[model samples]
Target: MHHLFMVTLKTEQSKRKQAFFWINAMAPLTSVILGSILVYMTHAEKHGVQVIGHLKKGLNPPSVSELGFGSPYLMTAIKAGATIGIISLAEGVAVGRSFAMYKNYHIDGNKEMIAFGMMNLVGSLTSCYLTTGPFSRTAVNFNAGCKTAASNIVMATAVMMTLLFLTPLFHYTPLVVLASIIIAAMLGLIDYGGIIHLWTIDKFDFFVSISAFLGVVFGSVEIGLIIAVTISMLRLLLTLSRPRTYALGNIPNSITYRSIEQYPAAANVPGMLILRIDAPIYFANTSYLRERISRWIYEEEDRLKSAGETSLHYVILDMSAVSSIDASGIHMLEEVRKNVDRRGLQLALANPGSEVMKKLDKSKMIEKIGEEWMYLTVAEAVGACNFMLHSCKSTSAALTNPAAVEPNTYDYV
Candidate 1:
């Protein structure tokens, strides 16, 4: 759908929307008219006649026998029809929502689902498999300035004209031509590069793409969908299992700090460590976060020891990127606090959102850690640590000032 959308139109949102509105309505109408034309052409052409003659082999319209309802072949056909309906509806909804996201609009998934389901139900009963909104058409609509539902009316009129006036022109169209057209359509749907892209960017999605493609080839369409959905859910679990959390620090020549992985030379405060988890804290990822913090602290201490420097005593979990936290995350937080306290290391928070703060409050995390420990910003935490360092230096200076009072150059040896 995305490829279709990209190929069919320019980048303008309004133009895309208008084109989508027209095409979405027109495509199906075109398909129906084309089907009728093919049916007519079958009677007129020699090859079509030959194909029809072959189709007539053992093709007796079902007799009114109770056995007809119980036939496995009939069951398979019914299942196939259901599969097509589901695919169409699911594709329609997903494509619709994706476009809505691109346009920064909100689509009610349930409402869209209802519309899709009803459309399929109607299509199925009317001798059409389930049909949903096509992404190409929707993308065109998104690019176009279609604000109303009137486009479909025009589409229906155009289809009527084609059926009434243009039917005879297509009477000699070969069966092989239609087969080629369908084969090309299927080829267009295949995304070999998309599979490779997914493999490079996300291994799990690559697995899904492969699983889905193979399932369709070797198994039933329903199996393909099931595998696709299951793979998607597993991918979510895999992501949460080891979420992308970065160790961040200040860039030397810039005001902004960056992920240490991206900029290793960035200055991290002495005796302090910054860990940035770029995901919502949930039950699925709570253990991963706990393990990450534990490993990071141990490694940081080891590195400091190797350098003959004071070990980092403060670990800041930068929650600015975190949007939400769950109960399991809260439990993990409590455990982290206890462990940090045991090691005489401080754990601090930075830029927790209001809702997250409220969750922390309800969990009694703020009270347990103390208000001074919670920092609103990374700079505030750095300033606090710097102040403590400066105060210690000032006290040392006061103690040593009188003992080393002036003119001690010759005593150095």
Candidate 2:
């Protein structure tokens, strides 16, 4: 019936609303009424069908004195409670955020976490088990065009009234009917289209989604949650371990520097190499950065040698994107500087942030590298290197070729 309603509904908004209402509300209600009638009109017991045989009357009594906080089991209970509490909170927040986005509203995640934590704390005192917003019920509420959380209030009131007065009415309710209602509500949560969309956009994201799905289907819900979270953390770690490093080149007729791979039209400066790091310099990535920078230097030198151009004499690091660095990162930079010096090339830094400046100053590296080598911009650093190279060439020309009348007139290009 749920599938039929979904398929037969028209494209009009009113028809969609009717479908949502029927599948989410009326269908379950109708199933319960029919089940009650079947049990009343027939000998349901002889058919081996189970019915609600009995129900306790009245509201739950207070259990304030039942609080347990003793010995070995107390610590175990705390650990288990915390684990389940975190998992439930994560699920509830994800569901809330999704609906909030769809409804064009904002939700403060931290505030939501606090609210959930407080609710659970109070609920425990009141003899309630761990409570969370179930996705199936949330989907039904959303589909019913609920304007606010007042719907939940209405639902709770209805449930309270049912427990207070309608307990006898549910005595003949069949277990199969209740199961049908649950199955119908849960069917709407299966989103095959979303999986296909993920596959088309990103294979890794599709893998994660499918892994979670299969894990839940084959293993337990806990296993699926663990697998999904583990995969996500691994992906984050992989990105940090291999952060992107780009060889920057100057845009023709402009001082702007960009990645040569991204902007193929950008040209490399003569007798100088510029490199950019695109993430924070941290201990985890320092080794990778060192090797990557070394590779860029060797590749640039090979290209210069093949072209029969002036050998690379200066390497300017564009540090604008490196917002922070650690001790290992600083050590890596020192090692890079030493390697460049061994290769008879000058190493310069451009636009180092205040934090990096302070660290370098404290480490006494700035004085060793000379404050004059650090420039405000990549363009300024390249220009200074070019001027120094031109001066050296002019002096060499004057010394080697004394017949030349004008030393400044010697062309270094």
Candidate 3:
């Protein structure tokens, strides 16, 4: 009925379409009320129709002393409370941010979390159980054209009025009717199109989504939430553990460097190798990164050997994307430097961020690797390495053939 009403309203040729839209939007609530009234008038309760019995009148009284802080169950309570709290917080923030994105607005996640935490604290003080922004309620609120948080205020005011003056009216509200309203609201949250889109775009994401859905349907909500969170964490760990490394090559007629795999036009520098690590340096990826760097060096050497060209000498690590480093990461870099030195090649760093510099300085790695070998940019590092390489070659040539003109060190300078 809700869908049908939307379809009709969409085609309505009326200047007061907004008024009609509001009326159409209220149809679900109206159906619940009128259905309850009809059941009450006809004495449907006599026919085994379930209705809400007497509800306690008035607002919730203070229960400041009712909170449990006892011995045997205190730890259990805390664990359970924390798990549910985190799940609720994640769901609420995800829903809120998703809607904010759809509406093209910014949502400060930290601010939202703080606001939710304060609300939960107040609720606990007043004897309320855990509450979260359920997707169904959020969808209905959005459908009802709520433009601001003021809608929440309006809803709270209505709830207070109901508690104070309209409690008796709910006595005849059938449970089945309430269930129907919930089912109607929840139908909008199915989002089959989203599932289809996910399947088309990323099968792994689709698998996660389907797994969560099946877990909830077959087991429990908590089980489903656990499965979803576990899969998400695993994905993050996998990405970090096997982070992508690229062989950077210089673009033609530009100082810019880019991945050769990504840009086929980018050309490798003669007698030099450049690599870009695309993730922060941490313990988990240090070993993998070390091995990957070695592989890149071996492949470059093989390519040079096959083509009868000069072997690699200067290995420049473009650390522009490396945001942070740990002790393990520093150790890995030391090992790499030793390996490069064993191969009679120099290791150079390009564009290390402040954090990386600080850590390296504290570990005395900067001094060990030579401060002069580090540069502000990859281009500068490559130029300096090239100049030094030419100087060496010219000195060697002068020794071999004194008649050969002196290698022009002035041109490099």
| Highest-lDDT candidate | 3
lDDT of each: 0.69, 0.81, 0.84
Provide the global lDDT of candidate 2 against the true structure. 0.81
What would the per-residue lDDT of candidate 1 be over residues 155-178, giving only the tens digit for each residue?
567556765666555544444444
Number of clashes found in candidate 3: 0
- Choose 1 or 3, whichever is better by lDDT: 3
**Which ten residues in a row are the worst by lDDT in model 2?**
3-12
lDDT of 2 at 413: 46
Order of quality (lDDT): 3, 2, 1
lDDT of 2 by residue, 24-67 (tens): 45555666787888887896955898988778767776678887
On TM-score, the stronger of 1 and 2 is: 2
- Backbone clashes per model, in order? 18, 0, 0
Q: What TM-score, to 2 decimals, does candidate 1 have?
A: 0.62
Higher-ranked by lDDT: 1 or 2? 2
> What's the C-alpha lDDT at position 361 in model 1?
98
List the candidates ranked by TM-score, beginning with the highest: 2, 3, 1
User: For every model shown, what is its TM-score relative to the native structure?
Assistant: 0.62, 0.87, 0.83
Per-residue lDDT value at 301 in model 2: 98
